[model samples]
Target: MQKVEKVTDKLPELGARFTLIIFLITIIMNWADKNLFSPKLNAILEDFGFAANETTPLGIIAALFMITTGIGMVIFGVIADRGQRKWITIICSFVYSILTILTYFTPNGIAGYWYLFFMRLVGGFGLGAVVPAIFSMIGDYASPDKRASTFSKFTVATIIGQMGGLALSSGFSEWRVGYLTVGLFEFVMAVLMIFIKEPKKGVSEEELHSVLVAGAEYQFKFKKEDIKILWNNKSNKWIILNFIDTIPGSMVAFVLFKYLDDYYNIKESDVLILMGVGILGGIFGAILFGYIGDQLFKKNKNARAIIAFFCNLAPVFSYMLLFLPLFNDLYVPDGVTFGELISYPEVQFLTIIVFISLFINQGNGPNWYSSVLDVNLPEHRSTMISVASFADLLGNALGPLIGSLVYQFISGRAAMITVAIFWFANSLFWIPVIRNIKADIENNKKILELRSNQLKPPDN
Candidate 1:
């Protein structure tokens, strides 16, 4: 009988603790940048040419920012794959936080256009760089069964940071306060990053050679050839489409709130409340969906993709429920405005809306991210993630501009409905893609199980 080794049989729990702690620190920085712009986005729009139905350049700033982030992910994924993960996370933590806070320095108006755009773009790049590094760090050291739960813990911490930002932003009169808060959170994490240890990559028997290049000679260093191999792999095409799936959701989350503020005559203050509820919902949602995905996926490796593919239906319906204007006719009973809100009704409704939307959004994350990882070859997984991240960014950059332009041409009412239709369209895109995804995941699992016979025995 072959003596088989379990990859995680004797792993130290300390590694997991340090990884989670570092992950939380990273979330602090992420929360800071994400929230810094939150309170001020409307004010900046007002300073420019605010209107009841207007979409600000902030949408563009965010879209463009995500593009840079995608670019950073691609660049840093290659670097982290070849070099050190710890320092890469540290550098990105510093860059994203500092740049995000710098947005507050921009003078309001058209003058701030370039200023805000650059700050947002740079900050996005920093976030892009670090997220994959965090994933890589955890993946390198985590036991297979623990990966999703470990990942979820980091994601939940991120939700906590986001919740903190939303809560604080809801209180403040000035946008700078939110921006300063995110900056401080990130700056502190930057210091904590100095202590993390980079984990060594595992080399299994089937992966003794390259995942893409067959028998072609190569070292596992960053090179143009490695990227070329990544691009030529046709099996990855669906993964690229999965990235596009993220854009519509991100658009609705980041820009739709601003649209809601204007259309419903609700205060921006209440929008933060709505987002706070979203943050809370996302925290729970990450744990729930991630746990489900991990557990179901154990029995059937294709389970995650299948779940994600089906779960896409949830957002499509949620957006429709949210966008339908029949409810718009419902009147706000007197006493609710941005200020002097009677907590009785105002707080309750906003919380419901936010929690529902958060559920929709968070449900999409784990299935989508984990599905891609399940299918990819370990040697090429980092590259695949980078490409997918890039594709998602490109789609994200455009989703907002298209949504904003639709509103620009029509009213926010029309734009909301159109966004609903767009969400449905995006969900449909998954149908054809998942057929291929299921096959790949099944094949990968078969191969992994076959190789288990050759694994080294666990040291007892």
Candidate 2:
């Protein structure tokens, strides 16, 4: 048995922390810009002379944005694995910002919708690269044990962006200003991206592995053949599970505002407040569950899957509260408008439930992200995540359409509850992962050892 040298030089801890912060802020800007239209959906359609009932166009545009985002992630994921992540992220961020700002320049009337649609479609391609590259960078910075917790912290930025977008769109009487604001912020962030140092791949493995096997070298470059390695891995099941799970998750993003305004009879302004509160829940959920995953993972490498299994079950029970007769009574009364019922106890109670449901709904993020990192090699991580992100985005792209079809056959309330079934099914898929997670971790360790042994000694 050969002894390994424990190198003292690691990526500076403060540098890693700063990198995460920058990535967090960048994503916040990206998501905020992308979702700026959510609260102002009706306002946007009104500008184009379409009735508020004409929501299919909105769904189509959102789906188009998501479709491009998915495709972009796959394309960029390949580049990130093989090329310079810093330049990829910088160029993409700049492009996305420029395109978003040009939303102010889209044509008017019926043509405006198509113009904005293609604008978002093109802009989403840039936005899509931001996430895959950021995740890939974080994979380099974060140790395998801390991947979920670090990723969860990063997700808090997304929740904040969601809230900020809703607030910006609804707060501005005119929706166009929201676009201007997000674009300006993104431009500032793109400039900031220029300063971020690209982290070396496999730094986490060198720094965080409990034991370094002598002569084990990490693979630095990824190849097209490695795609098969990602696909054949049993842990890739999480990729399919992400697809199943995000279908319902997308409805929460694209349909939640409409659902509250149209079905619950809540005013758009008030709905923003409710969504804001739910975002608070999401922040707490990501942090708390993320920490729990890190702790549990110290003992069980499969802990991410275990945490996800329970996280999936949680929303089922929480979302059911929305359907209870007691909960319904808390919504608008028969004679009372939402404005009048704002102070009612029942209304207040339902808002609290929304908070709980959202909290539980977000718990899946940390575990899922962490699990993906745990199973894949550093060289394959970006491509692996991008592949999963592609599936996740495709599901999200279809969510609004799926939600609409389900509503046609049932009450909107029932349709909302039915979304939980997908969550339940997503959890079931994790069961098989638990059985093989240990072996996968061990295999990864052995592969690292073999690769290290193949390297020639350094020249004096």
Candidate 3:
């Protein structure tokens, strides 16, 4: 392959910092857009003259949105691999923001339902495109050794965004205001993104650093044939297959609010507060596990997969504690403020369980992201992430649909027990990943070194 000459100067330290800030903000807004409507689903449905209990329409809408988002990720992941990622992300942000704001104008009745449904489906494209593009840039910007910690920041952002959206939409008297507000903020992020300069691919790789400093670019682009290369990689195969984890994870998440409401008689406001506490624990866990994964990764190439395996396994037990007869007697008293509710021994015990379960569960994100980046070539990173993310989307889409059926046929606890089994299965699947990661990393390094040699200028 002929070496491509570097076109722009290397990204400055200051510029890189700015870029990271913008990317984090954009991720937060994107996630908030996806989640804001969820907490207000009943309100939106009622506004369209549907019953509050009519979940079918909302379920279909959610499924379609995930389908569109997955399609967008595949399409834009290819573009992100071959084109300028910054512009792609900016355009996507703008597209989603506009659609989100337009949702405020939806009229009542069947017309309104169709409007909301189409808005979400079309809006998913923008939401999906940003992820692969941003992660691709992160792969280029973050040092290999510190990648888990860096990716953890994005994970934290996602949690905060989820919490923020739920809080805003549920707190507001009018749910449309939530969409309008988030849309305006996302638009501002798109404008701010205009200032970010795109980083050259593979700029952070140890093998290519010297060549990049000497003004050579890592110019590999994704081709249709490269799909075979992706499937051939052992680690990539495991990573993509890791979607099984998300299926039960999403099932548990989907029914959590309803379970609490039905079983514990907790109000929406109190549930939000409890969710906030759990999310805070999750944020702490991501940061802590991310740092730990990075340190362990310095010693063993398989450390991330190992950490992920245990993280997945540990959560199963905690979830059982929450769902099984262990917590059957607990109940939240009506009309108690959230602060007062936490003072109850039963509420406190349940809260602690939720916090711990979420804290451990969050460890999977950063390590999984770092492992994917480690096992792929720079040009292949976005496409690989898209494939993995689409698998995740599939699991998320199916989980709620399946969980709803299970909840109808059996008890809520039965549905949750199924979630635990799926989680255990997810943990077992990581064993193959642990076995394959070291060799994959070494193979990727060897390829980068060979490419770097070819890019080197001839000696005088």
Candidate 4:
């Protein structure tokens, strides 16, 4: 057996703060793409000469974008494992940014919908590529002990991006302006990313600290056979399969505002205010749970998954409070601003419920992200994340179409109830993960330690 050399120097911090800021902004822009058109769906439909009730076209467009995004995750994930992640991210960002700008030029009529559809389909690939690259870099930057908290910040960026997209698109008279604005921001980020340094693989692992500090590289690279190794990991199996949660999560995401409008006669402006409050809850939940997960991780390796299980279940009850006829008498008067809306006793009560539901629902992202990093090898992290994200993107792709069908055939209320049930079911998959996580983490550490011992230090 090989042995690690004595550490002669401290392992350098790899521009973690700067890198995180850039990646966080990238994540925000990528997620914003998902919601850019959603808030102004009616306006887009009207511009395209479609009937007010026609939503299938929009659903189809959303589904196509998700499908392409899934493909990009898998493709870019593989490439990121073997190539320079920095350049891959830059190129993908440029691709999506250009396509987003093109959306601003869409002509009015049914043709414009097709044009928008194509742009989304192609742009989604760019969006998909960024997920694996950013997460892979994050795994290297964040120490094992702090991964959940770090990951939580990125998850918060996702929520912020979602709200930002909604606000930007709806704030304007022309929905296309939102896409243009988002595209410009993405382009600037891609340019700035050129100067951010990529961290050495596995630098954050305690097992590799001595090796890296002694001026040796963690030289293991991803290989084709590693796919089997990844699939065979027990924790990876649960993580990949646990993507069912996203289906209902996406269902609610695509339709929640529309549901409010149809069921409660809530106006778009009022829904935005409520959604803003929900975002605040989500941000708070992510940060709080991220701290809780990190604290618990110190005590038990299984704590992250355990927290995730309960958090997933919490939303079911909260959604019940929001969607049920309990608030039938609550109404927002015309042109109510945020202050006036909150002043209403019933609206204030509804806001509390929204905040709570979103707060708990947001817990799953940070913990899940940390869980993926904890189980996979450094060389395999990008590919594994991509594979896992593909599963998630698939759910996102199907969610809108399925939600539309359910709402059309059954009723809006039935669709929401269905979302709650699926959300509950997402919690069950975590049991297997909680059971297997400890062993998997141990196995990963052992591999890293072995690799660390084999690394050759640079000659003086």
Candidate 5:
């Protein structure tokens, strides 16, 4: 029996250019997310004059958009695993973009709500297909040493997208501007994807079968087994880091924005500037973490997890700081027309609240997230990522519901604090995840390599 020579996962000579394209895709998708219904939310609410948190109808409408990303990704992940990325990427891009643009014409109040919902559902299906496919391509394209850094670029694009959405959605009091912005961007990106090519990998049915048997190929064989594998692998089991950290972040986030907007009495126009502060922080953090992650890769090759651990831990302090009235957050009330701190102490309070909020929230960036995706096996990359995405979307779906419940039972500071407590409890989940970061990365590589070879052609 002849031993197969191993292939190095180094960047192709044109790797920099390829990475740039991936970055653009990340930004576009994020823009689609940020702009979708958020900017129009307040306007829609005003138009409907519905009580706050009574947004069940729109929530359901918007949430339908996320469903496909969660449920659909699992199926498409399997498809990408089978090495059908070429067509999947192109088509999904088209679907996601067209649906996003359709958002512009959505009728306002109730009618507008349904339009956004329907388009989101279509976009979700398209989005469902692309993520895993991209990861699979990146897995093959990037060398292990530089992979984390490469993936960080994607995360940066995501941040840019969120920021873009922040700007687009918040740009107009009318919501049409946001819809147009997201729609045009998605359509343009879809058209641009025409020239980008990721050569088919393990492109044949036999090779596909070999990869699945070896755990490299996609499978239709959904079982308790798929999730079981997520927990069964000793190294993989620790991934609760992904699940644990993002929950707190997502749960109170929308409310926190409201809290800040209310705190500083910030107008719609300032929200972008307010959020932009965090985006700037993310840009700095990405550069810092990318540098650190690359260095750690040289020393330990599992730097992605280490960066995640540190990034996850940073929010703990930030969350607590917001709970403060004097020591941390100190923003003023929205409509107080008195002296700065004399006639209105609330404004002073709000000012402090936002400053800290900006400081603490900046931690949500590529520094914390891209590492997890970068380290997973390429074939299983989408599904593994979907695990994190699933946890997030699941939590994203659940968190706001809890916030609604809290608002019903409590009011003002108490309602805010109740959500904060729930957020803090999840911080405990990251500890186990971070402790074994190095082990998970190393084990994943070993497992995938041994299994991946089986997916390779006998000649290669």
Candidate 6:
């Protein structure tokens, strides 16, 4: 490979800050767009002339959206790894933005359903690339020491985006208007991204050689075999963990509303409030646990894995508690009518448990992202994340099916217990990760060292 500048100057502070803002915007929009149709599903069905009896198309649409996005993440991850990340961000964002704007044109009746489905499938291809590209950029900007903390800070956008999506579902009068609003926000972001500059890969490596190495950079190209690196050896364990952990996690995402409605006999509107209480924990977890990971990682290289292990573990016990009468009794007062609980006059202790569990569960995310970044070279980080994302999406897609299957075979409570078991098993998968983290990080540093030295000036 031809030698290029080894380390480009870091972006101006303002530019770097704006880049993060753009990333947050893109993520928030991505999440909001995904959620746009769900809350308005009934309205959409009615508009398209689908009878109440014909509901299978809804599942088909959702499945297609997820499956296509998951596939796109892997494909675009490779391209982002090899190309200018800013360009990837711009193009992907543009595609989705345009698609969203066009949603208004979807025809009515069966044709409209297929039209929207195809549009969403294409839009997912664009939305899927946003995460890997932006995250990889964050890795380049953030030093290894601050990586987890940075990820945690950025994670707040994810929560806001997720919750914001829910709000938009009900906030708008028409689903098309909701789509247009999200699309407009996305288009503005894509335009702003035009001003951002791409960072030099591996600008944050700590080794002294990285400073000394001049005029050389790691040249990467797409290869079928490169995908193997994402799963071979050490990376495979985390990939598997993402898939396994998300299986139950998806239950929380997909089944929680219905479960709460059924268990409490509360209105769907009331459950949203409880769900919001738990989501607040995600914000707490991302910041607090992310800080812990960064601080500990400064001393112990395995801190990320350690943090992830505990975060995953704590949720297991907290989730299990939900099955007990004691858990419900804490929230449901003596002779308290369901209407009183719905009013939320007192703090819902069950929501607190959910808050704690969610806090702990979401806490693992930043550490996991940072750990993966630490173990891979800058050139490979996006691909690694994308691969993990693909697994995560796959697991989430499967999660509903698994939950439904379990619900059919056993009681709903038992099905939830199964989710807890999945979480427990998620913790178990981290053991090997703890053991291998140091070696993997070292291996990445060694590769950087080799590239750094390879471009040294020849002796005079």
Instruction: Output the number of the TM-score-best candidate.
Output: 4
Per-residue lDDT tens digits of candidate 3, residues 69-130? 88898899999999988889999989988998998888878898998889989999998898
**Model 2, stretches more than 4 Å misplaced?**
1-14, 206-219, 327-342, 405-411, 456-460
Model 5 is weakest, by summed lDDT over 10 consecutive residues, at: 1-10
Per-candidate TM equals 0.81, 0.90, 0.94, 0.94, 0.78, 0.86
lDDT of each: 0.62, 0.75, 0.82, 0.84, 0.55, 0.74
The residue pairs in collision within model 6 are none
Q: Candidate 3 at 315: error in angstroms?
A: 0.8
Q: Model 1, 338-436: lDDT tens per residue? A: 444425353455467657656655655666666556565454566667778788878767776676777678766676666556566566656655566
lDDT, residue 265, model 1: 54
Residue ranges of candidate 1 with Cα displaced over 4 Å: 1-15, 35-39, 47-56, 161-165, 203-235, 323-326, 333-357, 438-460
- How large is the C-alpha RMSD of every model relative to the true structure? 5.3, 3.5, 3.4, 2.9, 6.0, 4.6
Clashing residue pairs in all predictions, respectively, total 2, 5, 0, 0, 21, 0
lDDT of 2: 0.75
lDDT by residue for model 4 (177-239), tens: 989988999999999888877777777778887567667977778998998999889999989
CA RMSD (A), model 4 = 2.9
Worst 10 residues of 3 by lDDT: 1-10
TM-score of 2: 0.90
Ordered by lDDT, highest first, the candidates read: 4, 3, 2, 6, 1, 5
Q: Give the lDDT of residue 4 in candidate 2.
A: 20
TM-score of 5: 0.78
Alpha carbon RMSD to native, model 1: 5.3
Q: Measured by TM-score, how close is model 1 to the native structure?
A: 0.81
Residue 131 lDDT, candidate 5, scale 0-100? 68
